[model samples]
Target: MTRVDDPATTSPEQARAAFRAGTVAPTSGWAPGFTQTNLIAVPRDWAYDVLLFCQRNPRPCPVLDVTDPGDTSTVLAPGADLSRDLPRYRVWRHGELAEEVEDVRGLWQENLVAFSIGCSFTFETGLRAAGVPLRHLEQGRNVPMYVTNRRCRPAGRLHGPLVVSMRPIPAGLVGEAVAISGAMPAVHGAPVHVGDPGELGIVDLGRPDFGEPVEADPGDVPVFWACGVTPQAALMASKPPFAITHSPGHMFITDRADSEYRVPVQRNE
Candidate 1:
């Protein structure tokens, strides 16, 4: 886990520098205010179904932006290249991980479509800013994610269980945490459930379906939120012929601010 305190140089170039120079291992703290996105690259043939899947399961698969088939750029973030901006990427073939690489420039195809899903990092940053403590960030570990017994609303060929990330919040601070996170609906807003892990069919706190598990203190209550991992689980269940996703913890940094996704305030007449 590399640490850099310089906030002045956290641009895309600097981020690439950090990844290339080995100054950053995971992207949790590298660009504090930037929106980090979960990536899913697929063939144009499957783009409609995948987009519909995200539409049906908005919580776990919040659609941040979608690139046109064979196009890499999206209006969400100008001047950002999907192929190289992210620190790492995973390529899957026939539902199995085939390769992990720093960049996917060489693997680009004319028939590919890119989808950027909202990552928990955005909400985690909000929680931290609101004085809510996160154990995984402190430990420099990826947030613990699980494949739950809950089935996601399926669309076309996409179908699977909902995956969630657990955060052990002090019992007293749970309400505040929920309120702060709930306000940001664009980024997997709010806790799906609070309190019992068994309710979600999560048998063990130490074992996670994906990412690393963090220590839950005595008074800390485990809070579960719908996760972007749901799509990856769907990929495994549905067995798409080919797919690509960001390597866990490595995300596509976008120029959009968290405020852009804030739930709007309405005035009653």
Candidate 2:
């Protein structure tokens, strides 16, 4: 694990700098107030399908920004190299994971286009402020993500199951967690399911398809949110010729604030 001074005090630039220097770890609590995103890059020929996939399944794949073909720079983090700044990356060839690396500068193709998708981690700051405890952060583990039996609406050439990140919210605070996250639609706003992992085809909470398993306290209820990592399932199923993505829990920290994507929620006084 790469250590930082403090998550709340760290800046997006600092986090990216550490990642660029080859620091590798889940970015859950890093740079708390800034927005973090999932990176997915595919050849220009397949960019449209990815875009359409995100459009049809906005809850799980909310797009923050899209880069032009061969561009490593995203408006989300100006001057940050998408090919190198994320802590870890997954390289895909013909739909199979070819390799995992700290940098993708060498594998980046001239026709590749990248998409930055909103992450649930971006709204975590708000949940914490509202007094909801984030078990994954508290436990120093990556948020547990599961691939469900639920299938996503297919795009032109992409199709896959819905993926979700689980958080164990106190039974009494499930509504609060929902309200807080629901207000931020761009960052996978709201819980997709609560209480029963079995309904989602998850037989074991202790094992996750991606990321580490989290410990839920006795009174805590499992709340699931639409995850940005949903795109990886598409990659695995659709099997594009070549692609790159941030490793499940490793994200690209952006310069934007969490507030930019938040919509004010009307609460009864």
For each candidate, what TM-score against the reference? Answer: 0.91, 0.98
lDDT for position 35 in model 2: 93
Runs of candidate 1 exceeding 4 Å displacement: 1-9, 20-24, 264-269
Candidate 1 lowest-lDDT run of ten: 1-10
lDDT of each: 0.82, 0.93
Residue 9 in model 1: lDDT: 46
lDDT per residue for candidate 1 within 1-269, as digits (tens), equals 33456633476456755564444356666567667788998998889989999999999899988888777776767866787667788898878889988777788778889999998787666777878899987787878888898999999988999999899999989988888778887888889999889999999989998789899878999999998878888888888888888887787777787777878644368
Error of 2 at 211 (Å): 0.6
Clashing pairs in 1: none
Backbone clash pairs in model 1 (N, Cα, C under 3 Å; residues 3+ apart or in different chains), count? 0
Query: What shift in Å separates residue 223 of candidate 2 from its native position after superposition?
Result: 0.4
